[model samples]
Target: MNKPPRKKNPTFGIAIFIVVAVLLVIATLFYNAITEKREFDRQNAPEPTISSDAAAAAATTAKPASGAAQ
Candidate 1:
């Protein structure tokens, strides 16, 4: 008895892989856009700035030793 021919296409598998890769790249770009928008919105929100005196006081408080002459 003669056996029938099998249909095996290697190009089909490569095409599927290429499609999945493109989808992943698109997803990454979408996710980056969302995160950047959120971060930009947060930056635009009102935030208090530290005054020079407050910054100086914080530095003094954080010092490990007194500023005595050696």
Candidate 2:
């Protein structure tokens, strides 16, 4: 006897598609957030201060040499 053909079930396929779509959307949002954060950091990064270097130079100059006595 010939067996009847199986009916295609769309429920599982639709569920998987929805899950994948949601995951993709979440991943895209996460990626966008990271990209925006990187851009913001690049734009708002602190400028290098020369005051520290100047302070170091001044300190070295102000110190008496080991060979010199006050």
Candidate that scores best on TM-score: 2
Local accuracy of candidate 2 as per-residue lDDT tens digits, 47-66:
76899788878887867779
- TM-score, candidate 2, is 0.67
Q: Highest lDDT, which number?
A: 2
TM-score versus the correct structure, for each prediction: 0.58, 0.67
Q: Candidate 2: how large is its RMSD?
A: 4.7
lDDT of 1 by residue, 1-70 (tens): 9989988999999999999999999999999999999999998986655786688788788444576554
Q: Among all windows of ten consecutive residues in candidate 1, which has the lowest summed lDDT?
A: 61-70
TM-score for model 1? 0.58
Off by over 4 Å in 2: 51-70
Estimate the Cα RMSD of every predicted model relative to the unseen true structure: 5.6, 4.7
